[model samples]
Target: MFDHVVFGVSDYAASKAFFLKALEPLGVMLVSEGPLGIELCRPDSQSSLCIRRVEAKATHLHLAFTAESRGQVEAFYRAALEAGGEDNGAPGLRPQYHANYYAAFVIGPDGHNIEAVCHQAEG
Candidate 1:
């Protein structure tokens, strides 16, 4: 539905490091870097996630990435915490969204709500 998403951050280096570690479990990696910021993408996807340095402080934004399974959601939460993310919501079934909506949420360095969700039923 989207080609890419860009996040404007106040501290480029810190946010970049946070994302690099946080998104690793999802198989997203740094694809390119520049003086202003860096870009990240999954191995097989054309869509990218870019974080740019801006003079102003970044506003809160909610971004969710798809997870292949519940286990991946759990991994994302763990990685996010280890990478300096604050816990917003722990990994669990969000039955309010749907029966199979398993997800985890974390507050990113720029205070954005980052999430990883899996929409598959548990066997």
Candidate 2:
């Protein structure tokens, strides 16, 4: 569990756009924004996801957020693509992970592996 997580990126605007689109389907909204960074959170949640501008090496971390349905996962994929995120994996069911395990993966501007997933399929 995280209270908040901040990502350091090369371009603040680009990262902001990527996060906005990818997180839209999850009901995440912009809580705050400035020249330094952008902070987004669920409408009724206190937890925050922050993207800040900085100079650092891109670390490899996979962040998978749950989706209510396969459609939501697919929407995230499309939004991420339109926002300049590189597709790591398309939306699909990975039986190896679980019976449902529908997910989509993308590489954000900071090189972090971002994903949207759902677990609502039968065996």
Best by TM-score: 1
lDDT for position 121 in model 1: 94
Tens digit of lDDT per residue, candidate 2, span 1-123?
788887787777778888888899888889998987888998788889887788766567788887888888999999998889899999998989987899999999879899999999733
Give the alpha carbon lDDT tens digit for every residue of 1-123 in model 1. 889998899988888888998889999999999986899999999999999999998988999999898988999999999999999999999999999999999999889999999999986
Segments in model 1 whose C-alpha atoms lie over 4 Å from true places:
none
Model 2 bad stretches (over 4 Å) = none
Q: What lDDT score is found at residue 39 in candidate 2?
A: 88
TM-score of each: 0.97, 0.88
- Sum up the clashes in candidate 1: 0
* Candidates' RMSD to native: 0.8, 2.0
